[model samples]
Structure formats: structure tokens, C-alpha cells
Target: MKIALAQTDIMWEDKKANLDIAETFIKRAAEEKVKLILFPEMSLTGFTMNVEVHGEYYETSSKNMNNDKSHWNFNRTLDAIKQLSIKYSINIGIGYIEKELEESKGKNKYAVISALGEVISNYTKIHPFTFGTESKYYCGGDKISYFNIDDFKLSTFICYDLRFPEIFQIASREAELITVAANWPKARINHWVDLLKARAIENQCYIAGVNRVGHGYGIEYNGNSLIIDPLGNVIGNCLEGVEGLIIAELDVDLVHNLRKDFPLKKDRRESLYRELAGEIIESIH
Candidate 1:
């Protein structure tokens, strides 16, 4: 399948400008005939945690009040995606913050809007980063989620969720391709690259990561968005701070071939792993 990673810079709370850019990118990706296009974390409004400034209640029909402070306003964004999907005839995965079930109110949770323009599944980040107590602003996702597009079992993880291998392991068990949409900063470029490769290698699945560019909230981003094959080889990537679509062709059978040759999944020591809960788990990257 042809997948395009839209490595665009977020507008840092500018929803209108961000939506405009998203529409343009969708048009560009459609022109290239991409089957799936992935955007960075919080693609519509960037990764600002200021709920008062960026959040709004989302509904099918609601007033566009600038002062409205809810979790997020996803109604407009969803309508845009529906229109674009019909126009482009392609699937898209974009991230955003949304008001959770009333039982989940006052917590932080990010959601991925599906290609059909409906929310197929919503995953709150399982591991929220604490460099600034991000979990405080959002509710953490309870479990790994996966969905199918054609014959592919696809899964997703948010920014800090990339650091946790257990999350990918769960997803990879059923997923042939895993895409992580992140707003990672520039200082951890090495970690980002290494971890992405590690995830693909360890899980034996195709990995596509979409990261933002430019700067936000005084933090600079090194946009090394990458697509890795099942063997953990980089097939395509973007340079830091560059704004463009990075496209790569991936095969579902390659994942099968790699796992067949390596047989890592079948040879797993799951019973022993439960006993080593406090011990360290190292990646093969």
C-alpha cells in the first residue's frame, strides 16, 4: 500500500490556519494517489495543553464561539475530513483532543479520527510524558487499539507512547503496520530515530511515524518523519524542519516473510516474561 506521512508544521493553536494547511496537504496526497495519509499529533491545533485557549465542545451542530472552552471542537474537523475523504477517495488518520465520556471528564485523552470520517476508535495516550506533566492535561488511553483498512491490520500510538515497547508489542500481535503520530521535540532526535527503528525491528512490522516541524512553545522540532520496513530498514524519511509529504510503498507480505524467517513471535517466552516484571527489557535496535 502507498502511505504518505504529512510532515507539516503545526500552527500552535491556530485552528483555521492549521485546517487550511491540512486541506492543502490532503489535496497534494490525493494527487499522488496515496492510499493512506497520516498527520502529526494534534494536527488541527498543535500540541498546546492550554485547554482554555484551544479546547471547545464538539457536536454535530454547535456555535463557533471563540470563548467556548471544552475538551476540543471536533465537529468541524470531522466534517472536513468526511468531505476530503470523499473528494480524495483515500483514508486519513489525524489526531486531536476530544472530550471523553463524562466519567472521563477532567482527564487527558487524545483521539484519532478515522478515514470514514467517523471515529472508529479513540485511544488516550497510554504513557503520557512527564517532562511537563502532560498526563495532567489529558487522560491516558487504557488499551492498544487496532483497525483494518482493506487487508491491513493498522494500529497507532501517540508521541510519548513511542517510548513504551509493551504497547507496540500488543499492537504488533495483530497489526501488520503501526503508525505513530507525534509532536516530539528536536532535542530527542536521536531517541526518535533509534526508537522508531527499534519498534519496527522488535515487533517485526512496518512502522510509519509522522512528526511535526518548526517550533512550538519554545521547543524546536526535528522533523525526521520516517517509514521503516518490517526488517527495520528506513525506506523513506524527511529532514529536520522540512515541510513535505514522505511517501513509501509497503507490502503486507513482507511482514509475514520476515516473521517467518525470524520466528520471534512464535518463540516468545511469555510465561517467563511475567516473572521479570521489575527487570529491564532491552530493544534490539
Candidate 2:
């Protein structure tokens, strides 16, 4: 599968401007014939806390999540991206705020739309960045989610979720590729690459991490978007501190063959880990 990492310069809290920028990137990637293109977290609006104004209503149960725009809270960002996906004949992985009725907060979500512009996998961030006060405004997801292209399955995750490996490990049980859409700051970019390498090596699956570049909320995000192989090798990078695209051709057969040769997942003790964790939590109490 040929995929693209679109490192973008997001306009802070501005959906319209960001969408225009995203459209240009989409058009460019389509011309390159990229099968799937992934954007950073909060693709349109930069990592901002202005959800009340920017948040879009989502029909959590709808099969055609992107096309069903009848909800009064639905916004233009969703509509534009769906049309872009269909018009360009390509799949898109984008991030947006999903307003939740219960908390009046939202879920930081990454959703995948098929080439036909049908919603495939709509994943919520499993870990909200409590350090950044994201937990106060967003609810964490309880499960991992995936989308398929033919027989190839790719699990989805968001920014802070990458710090927790347990979810990625669980997702790897059935997925060959993991997509992490993040807006991680420039100061801790080293951690980003190192963690991604570790996840790819441990899970024996391809990791595609797409991040944004430029400024947001007065913080710098130097895009070090990468496509790493299961062997923990950095096969693709779109240059640091700039907005660009990294194109990579991933082979699922490589994952299958590598796992057959290495057979690492066969040795994982899931129940043992759970038992140990349970005892730790009980002891703390």
C-alpha cells in the first residue's frame, strides 16, 4: 500500500483556513497517486480548547458517519473532507472534535474515510493528555478501532495514546499497520520517534506517525512524520521542522513473513500481565 504523511502548518482554531490548506495537500497527494493520506491530530483546527465553537456533532451509531450530515451540530469541515475524498478517489485519515452530549465535552477522534467517501473506522483517543488539561474537555475512548483496505487492516490511535503501549499491543493482535495521528510538540520529538520505533519493534507491525509542523497555541510542532518498518527501521521521513509529505510503500506480506520468522507475539503473556497489574492496583488500595 502506498501512503502519505501530510505534515501540515495548522492555523490555530481556524477550520476554514486549515481546510483550504488541507485541500491543497490532498490535491497534491492525489496527483502522486497516494492510496491513503493521514493528517495530524485536529487536522483543521490546531490543538486548541475552543471545542464549543469548533466541535462538530457526530452520529456515533451511523454507518455512513461522514455522509450523514443531518445533525444540527454537524459542521463544514466534515462535509468538505468527505467530498474531497470522493472527488480525489482516495482514502483519508483526519482528526476532529466529536461533541458528546453527556459531558458537553468532546472526543478527540481520528476517522478514516474510504476512497468512495464512506466512513470506515472512527477512533477516539484512548488517553486524553491530562497534563494539557485535555481530560477536562475530552473523554477518553474505551476501545481500539481499525479500518481495512482489502485484506490489510490498520489500527488507529491519537496523540497522547501513543505513550501507552498496551492499547497498541492489543490492536496488533489483528492489525498489521498502526496509524498514529499526533500534534506532539517540538520539545519532545525525540521521544516521539523513539516510542514509535519501540512500538513497531515490539509489535512487529508497520507504524505510520503523521504530525503537524509550524506553530499552534504558541507552541512549536516540528513535523518529524515517519513511516517505520516492523524491524524498527525509519524507512521514510518528511524532514524535520517543515511541512512536507513522506510517501512510503508498505507491504503487509513483510509483516506476515517477519512474524512467522520471529514469532514474538506468540510469547506474550496477556493474562499474566493483567494479573500482575490487578495485584498492583489492589495492593495500592
Full-model lDDT for every candidate: 0.79, 0.89
lDDT of 2 by residue, 1-285 (tens): 889999999998888888888888888989999999999999999888887877776555344446546544654566788899999999999999987444577889888988898889888898999999999988888988977986589999998888999998899989999999999999999999999999999999999999999998889999999999999999999878988988998899999999999999889888999999999999999
lDDT of 1 by residue, 1-285 (tens): 889999998988887898889888888988998888888988887777775444443553244444455634455655676677777777887776655333332223334444566665556677767786676676676888787776788888888889989889889999999989899888888899999999999999999999999889898987899999988899989877889899988899999888888889887787788757635443322
TM-score of each: 0.87, 0.94
The total of clashing pairs for model 2 equals 0
How much is the lDDT of residue 126 in candidate 1? 77
